[model samples]
Target chain A: SSFQNIVETSYGKGDKVSPFNVATSYNNFYEFGYGKSDPKDRSSSLKTAPWTISVEGEAERTGVFDLDDIINESVLEERIYRLRCVEAWSMVIPWVGVSLASVLKRFQPTSKAKYVYFETLYDPKQMPGQLGGGLDWPYREGLRIDEAMNPLAFLAVGMYGSILPNQNGAPVRLVLPWKYGFKSIKSIVKIRFVETMPETTWSMLAPSEYGFYANVNPSVDHPRWSQQQERRLPGGVLFPNVIETKMFNGYEEEVASLYAGMDLKRFY
Target chain B: MGQYFPDPGKLLMRLSGIWASVFVVAVMAMTLIGKIESLRFVNRYRRFIGLAAFFYSLLHFIIYLILFAGLSWTWIASDLIEKPYIYVGVLALVIMAILAVTSTKPMMRKLGKRWKPLHRFMYLAAIAILAHLWWQVKDDVSLAVYFSILLTPLLISKIPTLPVYKHFFKKI
Candidate 1:
């Protein structure tokens, strides 16, 4: 069945949202486990009730807010957006949330804030992968302050007109349409405003392959695989519909100016 | 897949890749373990490991054909151009097949001294297997990197001795 009450935007007007099953089932939440289906099976251990998010650092107002209050305080609309994974898979999602800019404005970041960092929940008991120490737990990701404020940047509360599933970052998650999926950190617990660039989990794991500013640029192919194409999710495998990846995931007109003078390859 | 295999493609790739690594590790152990006392008995199993690795590799290819390519020869043909990793993977699979077919004792006895040189293709097969895996990884490659690291000492040991580097290469 198709989704209802889609908060249509110029960014995702004609796009067909990927089936909710694919969006939730095919995930790369390493915190749950490594396999694509691991999260779907393992994330049941994640308890989402009574969740709290911390907003701190270089901000005028620094405090802890109840997750329910954050949802009740803001407008929640179903906004469909394209999500391109760095692994060359793509999905269209009807996410319910307000712009990240609006959320940040409530926190009131001071001029010293140059970057915005996000962290995921860390607990080996719930998130078994944390026991491996393969990655620095509390998976981290960040972006330039401006990028976090971009209208395309979203803090999601729900999808498919329902509360988020545990596998899809239940309570809340970040959604940056123009950047790779990893940049949109899942199961977010902390959002911080910092003076310097913050190192992301993937970039820290392999600096030579993954860059900090992981904007979707087809030209800057990952050393391992081509970024030029992606298999659109939700039956993409059966259809074998591999499409050419667009610059900034086809949001170039809206986001191109953000990096106008900077060399993407170097920053990438 | 039984009810437990959550994702077949992922598990197949991982299992198949490990088998390739296992084959090489066993080959190296066949020689390296001989030096360590009390471990000499393990050399007898090296051939079985090689055959098992090739079979696992074949299973990997079959799964990719069905899951990723939909078992279409035409799709496989076009993928050869689209995914560069396919070129390396197909070459490795073909080499693996050749090694497996030639592993029988009858063939080995027929070729005599020439059989050892022919079976040395195992090393090339291992490199190809690693390259196939290494080329496809998106970010995390610690497993593939670990396989390469394990192969490194064996690779260096095989290199011809140089007069200058004999000091370090002597142990290898």
Candidate 2:
């Protein structure tokens, strides 16, 4: 299905968008499988219709809302964002979505809502990879309330001006352009406003390697690999197209104030 | 080719690395299982499989150099410092190369008594490869765990003077 009234924005202007095939096929949705191609191959069994997102905790409206009802309330727009994976690969994606703050505001979050937590669908039958003991099931991610309110924080329901493929987080997913790709949880089933920090999937799996913030900082290297450079998608066989990474994935001017006076390395 | 391999460099690198490990494990399994009378013929192909493992390792290394690092010495040097698993993988490759070069009929006959001890270094190469796999894992350890389980029994059989091997084989 195609989206109507997608207002074009100059969000990622002057950036070359990655090929639609590459962006859709090469994904890190572990709910389907671990291999890069596994999601595309195995996600056919996933049932995405009649999807509903349950809003809970610290919000005035705390009930399950149909995904269509949520989409109808907001105006969709085209925002080209560069998605940088923690594995040191990057892709420029043209995503269709609305600002996350717009959706959260309707829920009427209370003053005590310090953090916004998100959870993915957890059915092992629908998502076969859940049977394997790779990560704690129901992939979870969280962001500070202020970060979620950032203009770059997006809740993408479609991509390339059409409905999302199942492997690329169909129905609904979070897209935070400034943070690493994993922080943008996919196929979300639940969203909650909490007072304290929520335990995210990757950070809980390896606390020393993945942190809650997960801001795209080139200075801080992962425990195993250096984050100084990344291979842009469609890299040739002989030339990898490796380029130096940027602070906050080149969104420092927009997001730097969110981390004012806080030590990024310590938070990372 | 574009339709099949969206990223040829990454696909080839992964294929070469995985095939190298698979052949290494195959050679070890054949050596252990060939001890049985019914499977004695499997020993005849052990040398070929070991050489195949070495060639795959060489391919994996070449791809890493030409395709990944783009033949840049600076990038290679940086990788040596930043990624310790690269050195461990190199260690395994170097051991396999030495074993392959020495795997000749004349060399085997000349060093009759010492040949068995030198060839036993395959075990060391296997351990290094295992470390290389485990040390670089980002989140999932399932592949490393699977390889470790596959190698555990073959490693146990290498223990000299173990009565369990003798007792178990007598019944077979």
Candidate 3:
């Protein structure tokens, strides 16, 4: 069936909410020992009931937001968005949550706050990936002030009209539709508002490979592969695994204005 | 070569098996290197530097079937087809596979008289594999360059063949 046909068949034409584009975009970084399909298997070990986020740095109300309180306090809405990975693969996901701007508003960052840094849950006892140090333990990501404030930017609570799977960033995770997939930090535990740019996880590891912004632009090619083409997830045998990538992943209406004067070639 | 095998078809199948065994050994070595996590393990990357050659040969053989024999069987056979470079890559894999399998004592004992001639297939396989990789590269030449650097010593070691090439070059 065509893309429109698939969407209409799954969700009624008038339905405001739709299912997340379901595909096992495998994260097989097996250093975690949870196995190749650990995201589906071992993520059950995560305890999401008593969660808390440390809101620190330039925010005026710097304190902890209880997991339950955070969920109850915010408004949740469904936003159909495209997720483009740096590896040249793409997926359309229907996320449930309110704007990131609203979440930041409650914390009330000071005027000096130019960037927002997010830290994932660091407990190695629970997140097995952290147990063995392939990365620096707790994965960190940051967003520019304008990028965070964009209405399209969301603090996702649910996927596929249900609660998020632990592997897909359960409880709450940021989803920046315009930027590359890494900008959407998963299993968030800390939110820090900072004056200077915070070091992002992939960028710190290989600065040349991963940029600070990490936006999805067709013109900007990765060191190893071209970003000009993408393989839409769950492609059929007849369809082939290549598609023309669009600037901002076709979210030009909402995000093009943010990077008006800056050069994407240099910033990319 | 055809005299020992008798049937050309059987020879191809036997050749394919040899290639598979070589691939298995290389994969095992890579797995061991990944687990060792020592300073020597970092140096062990060279153990499987030419993996793309194997993958390319596997792809090449698969595509030949799809494009030629399986052209009419699109629905069932189309699933077997692969990307272009991947299709052209099987020659490398088959060569590597033979080299790996014959590296064993029992296989060497079985093909005592023909072992040397069989090993010569590696040269053809290496060149075909490089060509396959070179054709598939779109914009990034780094990956091709990496493979080229890895194969350089392997190619250069056959210095005696230079005279045959020099004779061919004079004719050209």
TM-score of each: 0.77, 0.90, 0.64
Scored against the true structure, residue A248 in model 1 reaches a CA lDDT of 95
lDDT-based ranking: 2, 1, 3
**Sort by TM-score, best first: what order?**
2, 1, 3
Cα lDDT for residue A43, model 1? 92
Q: Residue B72's C-alpha lDDT in candidate 3?
A: 31
CAPRI grade, predicted model 1: incorrect
- Angstrom error at residue A229, model 1: 0.7
1 or 2: which has the higher DockQ? Answer: 2
Better of 2 and 3 by TM-score: 2
lDDT tens digits, residues A147-190, model 2? Answer: 99998899999999998899999889999988999999999999
- For candidate 3, lDDT tens digit of each residue in A1-268? 0011112122112323212323322433222343324565677777776779999999889999886676643355767777777756566677666678988988889999999999988876777767764466578999988899987788877766667777787778898877888778888999999999999987887787789988889887665445766655533333323467889887788799999999999898
| Two-chain DockQ for model 3 | 0.05
Task: List DockQ, one per candidate, in order.
Answer: 0.17, 0.38, 0.05
lDDT of each: 0.78, 0.87, 0.63
Pairs with backbone N, CA or C atoms under 3 Å apart (clashes), candidate 2: none
Off by over 4 Å in 2: B1-4, B33-44, B69-75, B105-114, B161-172
